[model samples]
Target chain A: MSNTDLEDDLRGTFDRAAASVPMATDLTGRATTDARRAQRRTWMISAAAAVAVASIAAATFGLSGGRSTPVQLPVAGGNAPASTSAVETEPSVETVSGTWRPVQMAGLKALSAERPEDPVLVFRPDGTWTGSDGCNGLQGTYNIGQRGEFTAKAGMQRLIGCDNVPHTGVLQSAKRIAVDASTLEFYGADGRELARYARAR
Target chain B: MEFEEYVSARGQDLVRLGFTVSGDYQRAEDLAQIALMQAFRSWRKVRKADDPHLYVRRILVNAYLSMTRRRSFTESPSAEIDPPHPVPDPATDIVNSDDLWRALAELSARERVVLVLRYYQDLDDRTIADMLGIKPSSVRSTASRALATLRKARQSHHVS
Candidate 1:
């Protein structure tokens, strides 16, 4: 066949394929929701950066003898006083360095990831984590306190709109974490079980 | 135009373009939504572009390319096209369309992308090259090779 014939065939194929797509349901709403989430995440990251900058400025000012008295900055969560000593004690905990797949979330066996894809979380030993929230990629920093008191700050993420995976929500609210050879579970601030995950083989 | 207005008017077309390029309906929707969401986030700059539609299309295409690259190398194109499509009737135009679809699937991503941008989107070689971040000569060569493969597939289908 001539190139013209091939080109016509190409156009026809695309037109038919495109026609097969049903009208997207509530695309505007979905996009708007995703945009809002992205904006919120961006604001959170900016606020964290600003706080870091302020801490640095405070440290620099104190070192330059600009103040007669030492400044006592509040620790994270602002519930405890900041440590003044240069040395710190290490928390005794096993590393949660592996990939885990959600088995249950918030008392619901059926997960948001069931429709499009399954969510997976990978925690590295270096206090960093990355995974897919079924659709969009997510990355964040995590810290495990002395008694498995877990805190996570979600970092930058792909702004792609997807089904609301409970994994991210569970992680953000997780105050305690437990892990074994085969399973991982997150607990809320009130000690309520939030989610459970199985180590991916 | 306002971002919402733009999405209302051209969203379906963008999704269609995405489907044509990705060959997956759900993924096409996601790509279109993501592109639209991104455009919404920076609607001012997007609206100021020479062609806002093309700008969004570029984002959609780039997302698809990046996604495929991140996928496991063992993945198969046939696996990605998992949704069951209707059997092609020999007497209807869909028979040729189905044959062409399979042929398109057999082509590499870059080759298929070039053909879709060139024939489906009616873009020129230079523009296609610019969007794909390849030399124009490479685009021409890839298109030529892909066309030859499609012709062969068509001839073989006719023979059978």
Candidate 2:
């Protein structure tokens, strides 16, 4: 038989077979739930790593006679103080590493308006950070200096641009980092708020 | 379009494509679920592409290929002995659709994938190549080889 005839025959057979397959009604719900669960799993792993790193830092500081300061721990369902000064007293490593989802971006509210999935930032204890601003994936190295000072080396990022989202500025200009309860803040060198995020569930 | 809207629009079509690739309804649903989940996680980037459906299709193809590879490795020995069944004569039943499907199932996974993308999905060689991450020339050669295998199977069945 000719090639065209064989191709036609296969197509006809496949069409007939596929017609009998039932449509799954709950696909959207299941996929959405699974995606959220996967995101949560990633957040949990990062949070766990943050906890481990915080423990080690605390132990080292205790052995070295570090200055004592009251650090506000993350409390479930508790409101973070509106004042940034109250939160940055003594930022622990636990406050530095973990998954954070962007909730607000100063002067970029339009970018956050329509997106249901927030951009995520994940800081690792190994001085590396990875994130996505709901568009491009970002990775870089970070350093925490004395007196709540933070600096991040500009790292490689994908160039895919999303509408209205200034992912580059938010990720690159992140000169200062602060954590208070579930709230995490990124600031520019000028001390202006670049972006704000909440601990991801 | 929003991620939920995209899912509502193309979810069923993805499932159908999965069915074509896997040749099983339940496996198709599982594969579609996995592909859609991945798409959802990266929807921000995926939706910005020239063809979001193509991205999802690539995910589906990759998942199917990986699953088949893993299954090939972990496949357990079959205990039941198969009874001899008569092969249908292609001379008499020239258009026997069941024989064509059985023959398709007998092809290698890659061959079946090429044939399904070419014949069933009605995709061009370039598109199939992009989906499978292969060269267009490789797509043509794979499809040609798959067709030859199917033809040989049909002819052998007729002889028996």
Candidate 1 per-residue C-alpha lDDT over A65-165 given as tens digits, one digit per residue, 9 for 90 to 100: 65434333322344432333232233213457788888766534346445455679888764568888777888876667655666666866766666646
Model 1, runs deviating above 4 Å: A65-201, B72-92
Model 2 agreement with the true structure over B25-104: per-residue lDDT tens digits: 77789888999998886676679889898888888888888777763543222111122236545333334666777777
By TM-score, how accurate is candidate 1?
0.58
User: What is residue B38's positional error in candidate 2, in angstroms?
Assistant: 0.8
Clash pairs (backbone) in predicted model 2: none
User: What shift in Å separates residue A89 of candidate 2 from its native position after superposition?
Assistant: 31
Steric clashes per prediction = 0, 0
Go through the candidates in order and give each one's C-alpha lDDT: 0.71, 0.68
Q: How high is the DockQ of candidate 2?
A: 0.37
* Chain B alone vs. reference chain B, TM-score for every model: 0.86, 0.83
| lDDT at position B80, candidate 1 | 27
Off by over 4 Å in 2: A54-201, B71-95
DockQ score of each predicted structure, in the order shown: 0.46, 0.37
